[model samples]
Target: MATISSTWRVFLLIILSLCPITLSATVVEDLKNLHPPPHFNSTILSNCLKNPSLRYCSSSPMMDFDEIFKFTIVASHLCNESKNPTCVETFPNVDLKNRPNIAPLYLSFDFFWKYCPLSIMSIDLSNNSMKGGFPTDVLYCTQIQSLDLSINAFSGDLPIQSFSPLTNLTFLNLSYNFFSEIKLSDSQFFKRFNSSSFLHSGALLDEKKFTLKAVILLVGFPILVILVVVCWVWLCFQRPDFLPRKLQRTRRFTPAILKAATAGFSNNNLVGMSDVVHIYKGILRDGTEVKIEMYWDDIPRDSYRRFVEECKVLSRLHHKNLVRVLGWCRSRKFRAIITEWTEEENVEMWLSRSGPSWNHRLKVLKGVVECMRYLQEEWPEVNYELKTNTILLSDYMEPLISRFKVGDQTSNRKKIYRFGVFLLEMIQNKKGQEEFDRSYGEFIKYITTLDPADLHKMIDHRMEVTETNFHQVKQVLSLGFMCIDQSNNERPSLATIFNIIARAYKVSLVLPSTNHRIFHGERFKGHMPVQIK
Candidate 1:
C-alpha cells in the first residue's frame, strides 16, 4: 500500500504537469485560458496612467480582461486578488451563468485596484494558509479605512509604510504569526493602541514587543547580570554613558559625480520613483554606474543608520538572486549607497517583461532564500524597508532589492517585517490595493497543495522552478516565517534561523513549518475557516 501510494503520487504529478502550460504568455493570454474572457487591447488605459490623480478608471464602465490588464500594468495602478474568505465553487452554478460577467484571476485583481485602491477599509486575512504579506508600497495607500490581518500565516509587522497612506485608518489589527516586534509610541498612529491590540494568545507578560536573543544579548546579554540591571535602570530611567554621541564628521560628496549620475536629475533619469525621496542615475568618471538617492532633512539620525546597515548587510551576501551592494557613504548633507547599475530592469519589470519562467523563478527563490539567510539580520533600530516592490532587479535578469532603507526611524524593525511581507507578495503577484480585497480566496487555494515549487509559481513568471528542489524551497519559506514570528523569541536568531532554514525539514527547532499539510496553527484563528474544505 505504501508503494501504491508513492506510485499514485507520481502518476498525479505527471498529469498535473500538463494542467496548464499557460504560465507562459502575456497575462492577457493567461487569462483567456483561465476564463475565456473577451479580448481587449493595451491602448485602452494609456490616458489614465499618465495622470493617476484622475480617478476616472475607478468608475469607468467595465471592460474585458486584456484591456484592464494593459491599463493596470501601464498605469502602475494597484489591484485586488480576491475578496471572499469562503471558497465558493462557481462552477456549474447559476452564479457562473454569465461567463462574461465572471472575472478572470488577473483581471479581478486588476479592476479591484482600479475601482477602490483605498476603499478597502477592513481586511481580516487571519489564519488562512496565505503564504505572504503586504506587497511593497501598499503601506502608503492612505485609503485603507480599517484592517485586521491577525493570526494568519502572515508574518511581519503592521506594514507601517502601508499605514503611511492609510492615515485615515481608524482600526488596525495585526496580532500573530511571526509579526515579532511592533513599536508603540506617542505619535498619532502610535498612540492609537496599547500592547493588547497587537499580541497573540501566549505572549510574554508585560512584554509589549518581542526581542530576539541576539537583541537581548547585544543590548544586555553581553553585560554582567549586575551591570545589566544597573544599565537597564540607568538607561530606562535616565540617560547613561552609552547615550548616543553626536558625531560631526566631515561627510564627503562629489557633486560632479552625482550630477553626471543623475543626468542632472532629468525626468527620464529620475531613478528614484517616489515623492518620498529623490533617486538619480549617476556615472563616476571611471564610467562606473551608480544610483544616488536624496532624502529631505529633519528625518532623524536613525534613518541614516538603516542606510548604512543595508549597505553593510548586502555587501556580505552574494548570490545570483540577491541584489549586489557595492558601497555606501554617509554625508552630513546626504546619505547614499552605490550599487551596480541595472539598466536592464527590476523583478517587477521582469514579471511584466517575460513573466519569468518557472525554472528561473525557483532559481530566484533559492537565491533569495540563500541570500536572506546569509545577509538578513534582525535590527530593531536599523534602517531599511523589505517589501516586494523594494526587491529590484538588474538588466541581466537577476533579482535584487532596492537600497534597503527607508528614511523612517521605524525602518529597521519594519524592514525585518517587510521581508515577511515580501514572501507573501511573491506567492501572489497582485498589486497592493487589489490584495486588500482579493488575497483571502487566492491564499486558501494557493496553500493547500504540497507541490514543492508552489512558491516559484506565484513569483514573476519569467523564471521557472523546473529544477524542483522541493526541500530547498520548502526550507527557505519555513525560514522566512521564523524570521517573521509575532513573538521575537519565536522568530529565530539570524544564525539559528538560517541554520534551521538550511536544514528545516531535516532538523526541527520550535519554528512553525508554515506548511499547510502540517497545520500547526503557526498563526491565529480568524483566517481558519469554520469548516475546513
Candidate 2:
C-alpha cells in the first residue's frame, strides 16, 4: 500500500509539471483567436509568452525558450478574458496584405490595453513609421506612466481632453510628428509638457490670421530697416575700423564688442561675481545673448593659466549637461570666456523656491553624475568645481553642470568625496544648504552621525516620500556616506557609484570592466585592484 501511494504521488507531480504547458498553449490559442488577432508566429508567441514585458523579445533566433511556456501561462492568467474584452474594440483590423511580415507582437499593445490596462505602465511606439492622427485611444489606458509617439507621421491637433483623465501620465513625447494645430498655451493639462515635446511638429504653430499687428509690422518694417541701414552706413564711415573688425570676426568677439554688449560692464548687467572672475549678461550686435566670464586683474598667474586650460577644455567638450562655450577673449588688459546665455536660475535658487519633486531631483542628480563620469573617462586629469551654485537649471528644469575650474593635483577619490558632499546638500534640503555654508569637515561629521531613521528629516518636506521610493532615497544616502568615507580605499570608484545609483533608480548603466593589467619590461602586474562591481 505504501509503494502504491508513493508511485501515485510521483504521477501527480508529473501531471502538475505539465499543467503550465497545457495552460500556455490554451492562452496562445485564445490570443490567436481574438478579433484583429495578434497574428504571432510560434516563435514570437513563445517569446511574448515567456516575457510579457517583451524585454527579452528580439529579432534574432536561437533565443532562450525555457521561460517562454512558463511566462505564457502567467500572462494568460493575468489576461483572463472573463474580466475584460479579448481585444480592444478601438483598434482597427490590421492590413496583413499590405504588410505581411508585420510581427504579431507589435499588436501586443492591443492585448495589453484590453486585458491588463492596469499593468500597462509605458508605451513606446517611436520610430515605427506610425501614420495618421494621434492614437487617442491610448490615453484610455489610465495607468500608463510614459507615452512615446515620436518620429511618426501623426497629424492633427493632440486631443487635449483625452489627457485630462491620464493622471498617471508623467512623460508624453510627441516630437517629430506632422501635428497641424495644437494650442497648449492655456491648457493646464498640457502645461506639464515642455516645448521639446512638440518640436519638429506642425502643431507648434497654428495658422495665424493677419491682424492689425501684422499690418503695422508690414507698414513699419521697411522704415525701420532703412533707419538701421542708415545708422550702419554712418557708423561704417565714422568708425571704419570698428565696423570692419566686428564684421570680419563673427566667430571671435573682441573685448571692445563684449564691453559694448554688456553695456560697458555696467553693474546692472552683472549676473554673478567670484573672487577670480565676474560674470556679465551680454547681447551682441547680432542679437545673440551670451554670458561673459571676465577674470580680475588681481588673479594670480597660476589662476590665469588655469583659466586658459579651462577654455581649451570647454572649447572641445560638448555634452548636453555642460554649458556651451561660444568664444573667448584673451589679451594684455582683458581675459574672458563667453558662453551661451541662460536666464534660468541655478540649483541653489531653485531649491530655495519650494524645491522640486523627488523625480526632478533624481534627474538632476543623474545628470550631474553622468557629467562627472564623462569627465573622468574622457579627461581624468581635469576636475569639476561642482556645487549647487555651479549647477544651473535649463528652461525644462534640466540640470546643467558648470564652472570647470582647475584643481590642485588630487586623487580621483577626493573628487568623488566632494561630489558626495554636493549630493548630500541636494538631498538634505534647507539643513543641507545651511551645512553647505558651514565648513566641509563639519558637514561630513554631521552626515556620518545621521541615523537612517532621521534621513526623512534631511529630505525636502515639499517632496513626498512613499514606501515605493523609500528604498531608493535610502540607497542614495547610503551611497553618499560610502562616497564620503574618510579612508580612500573604503570609497567606491565612480563607475561603482554610478552603477549603484543607477540600479537603485532602476536605470541600466553599462560600465567598462575595472580589472586591467600593467606590464613594465619583464615585470608584469596581472591585475590592478579596483573597487567596482
Question: Evaluated with TM-score, which candidate comes out highest?
Answer: 2
Predictions in order: lDDT: 0.45, 0.63
lDDT of 1 by residue, 312-389 (tens): 655654556554565655445655656666664555555555664334544444445555554444333224445445
Off by over 4 Å in 2: 1-252, 264-268, 272-278, 298-309, 432-437, 504-533
Q: What is the lDDT, from 0 to 100, of the residue 310 in candidate 2?
A: 70
**lDDT score, candidate 1, position 153:** 50
Per-model TM values vs. the true structure: 0.34, 0.45
Off by over 4 Å in 1: 1-251, 260-268, 272-276, 296-339, 376-384, 406-421, 429-533
TM-score, structure 1 vs. true? 0.34
Lowest lDDT block of 10, candidate 2: 87-96
Question: Tens-digit lDDT track for model 2 on 63-152?
Answer: 444333333333443333223233121111121222212322333344333333234466666666667777765665666778777777
